[model samples]
Target: MTERKRVIQTGWNLENSYARLPKSFFNIIKPNPVSSPKLIILNYSLATSLGLNGQALQSNDGIAVLAGNQVPKGTLPLAQAYAGHQFGHFTMLGDGRAMLIGEQVMPSGERVDIQLKGSGKTPYSRGGDGRAALGPMLREYIISEAMHALGIGTTRSLAVVTTGEFVVRENQQLGAIMTRVAASHLRVGTFQYVSKWGTAMDLRALADYTLQRHFPAVDAGGNQYLFLLREVIKRQATLIAKWQLIGFIHGVMNTDNMAISGETIDYGPCAFMDTYDPETVFSSIDIHGRYAYGNQPHIAEWNLARFAETLLPLLHVNQDQAVKLAQEAISDFTKLYHYNWLTGMRAKLGIFNEEVQDEELIEGLLSLMQKYHSDYTNTFLSLTFDTRWDVALFGSTEFAHWYELWQERLGRQKEQKASSHQLMRSSNPALIPRNHQVEAALEAAVKQGDYSVMERLLDVLKDPYAHSTEQIDYATLPAISNRPYRTFCGT
Candidate 1:
């Protein structure tokens, strides 16, 4: 077989619509240069989407750009300023170690923010070394790409490069940088920053610009700020529902990490649940279990409440009336969330028609899973195949009772069995970025300098719903020894 040659482009087209914002919004800071920069991996598909040549991005000059040693022409690199509530404590937090290189306007006219993560220290370093270790950077690359392949909205890793530097954490480790692509870096915390520090004029400008950029389709005649709040709530409702359906847990869901664009932004300390448990908490820092698996919907509501407060001034002339308006919008979060969540659950169960009893039926399965400590992904995948793991719940009288009811319900739908089966298969993935599997890959890469595991994991994750006998091992639950696994924040 002839070896296929890789394509290379020598030029880049970068724009800076975000840089056009007032200087108060961000700091014009350059990345702290790294030593011995070397290319590690390039996301060829993502590069192509952004009109970048993948082969060039892996070259020497590209390594310099990725390592923050050189800035590409037409790029305005800067660190964004934002405040967030971390572990319920309000504090000022910015890009400490990351910088936005610029935005790329693709041929489709969609603009994406290109940022370098773990580049180096910035003004917001907060008396800490603003550098990233290789393991965490690679973790983000693996999980984010997996999320994208699963059809979830998320910031993507465009490339990863080694800095040939060392960072001290629990131990000394090699440093690295990851290039991230997102719709925009605007977050609920971005509004919080302007509201708490910037002037009312600044707040207004930010609101107007956000509308122009993200919600241009929103009707401008009425209260646009309120419209923005409603839209954000709707997107978050849908997003969180998807998260729950997939058994994914975002371990650190602080306000700053919640992107206003509705994409899953920060991937630090996130994991996919193996066993079904409502109160599962993985982040080592989540001592209080504030951001648990079941708490996600509630925390999402809480974050939206904080976002609503920032828009109160723009909501109405009278503070009292604005409060009332914001409260009304916030009230819709539960209804919207439950509707989206139940609808997704129905699809996962292969139910084409919804009835009043659907929610009860869905909750029953979840309750049984929790009670039996069943594997989350396998339980759903079993149902898709018209079979059950005999060990989990299939043999239980209660589950059999529920199964009878489910069968009757499925019979009522006009859709054929094959159609419903297809829906169930697509709705429930056969694979996820499992915590144990991810750790194994990271250990191989960081300790043995073996990236083959990471590459193989990515190959299976790219088609999460497919059934491949050779890759069936990826679908199995982790062993008991790997139980109660904890994830840590990248910082």
Candidate 2:
């Protein structure tokens, strides 16, 4: 077999961004050196898709590049600046602990941002060592991969490199860096950063650049800022709806965490629920329950308000007119989000068409699921074959009555029985990276040096909807005793 050669682009596009603004916006710095860099996990498949040789990824140089010990030939390392609302308090937060190494124009013609998480300190470091603990690093790798498998748009982990050092968090913890890939790391807070600095010109320039890059169709129009605002709202709503349907809690839904590209970017303090609870929260620091499961939609609206506020200056030629236009854009978010959420619920219930009472039927099913404390993913996946979701577990013969209601709603769908069944099965995943399973894998890797468990979990997570008898263990949720697995920010 001819050896597949590894390809590296010779130079970077080196596109300077908002960094052209005041120097206080961001502090430029290189990543800190690690004692011994070793690959804990490598996403070889993602590399191949980005026009890289799978074999070359196993090379020592590959580990060095991934560990942030050496920048790639075309890489441009810089920290992005942005402000975020952390724990309901507006805070000026930047890429304190993260660095955008550069942008890569993949063979597929898509430009992906190559970033290193836990790459060391920047101006935004806020008096802390910008290092990541092993548990949160592994959690991001697992959950981000799980999101991709669940057919959601998200940041992808390209590789994980251990620093061979300890990061002091809750206790001394292993340190690691995650090579994260995203369409763009531009967040809603990026706009806010410029807006608050009395730099409307930069904001407008950023908006134009963003529209051309992400929303090319809108680049030709008047009121393009409003167009970008509306489109971003739509995508974000759909993304949040998918998160809710999967029983995933983002834990931190800060405005800064909201990506303008509508991708799930930050994985800090994120967790998946084992039981159906509308108010479930898993981030140890989210004592206020602000970013709980049921509060996602409302929080989304709040973030959109922040985005709208940032865009108001460029949204309309007149200042007062701008506020009105932005308000109009913000208004579209709730309707768009609820529509997407309802449609997702319809598929979960096997209802494929618009019926006058479809929304009620969907709500009825959710109410029963909540009352019974059912597993979210399993309940949805099981509806394809059987609507009878463990009546005994529901603690009531009333589940039988609810199942009958579900059947009646299913009967109204436009698709025939077999087609609807196929649609439901395809849309609902049979597996997710259950919290317990992820914790178990992380424990083995961090404590026992057993990465095989994590490797196997990734394999199972890749084909989430597939029925694999051998991987039956992957389908079960964490036991009741392990119901709410807490996630953390490796502080």
Q: lDDT tens string, model 1, 174-227?
A: 999999999999998999999999998899999998888888888878999999
Q: Give the TM-score (vs. native) of candidate 2.
A: 0.94
Off by over 4 Å in 1: 1-11
Model 2's alpha-carbon lDDT is: 0.80
Which 10-residue span in candidate 1 carries the lowest summed lDDT? Answer: 1-10
- Candidate 2 displacement at residue 303 in angstroms: 0.4
lDDT of 2 at 316: 72
Best by lDDT: 1
Candidate 2 ranges with C-alpha deviation above 4 Å: 1-25, 387-389, 393-395, 482-484
lDDT of each: 0.88, 0.80
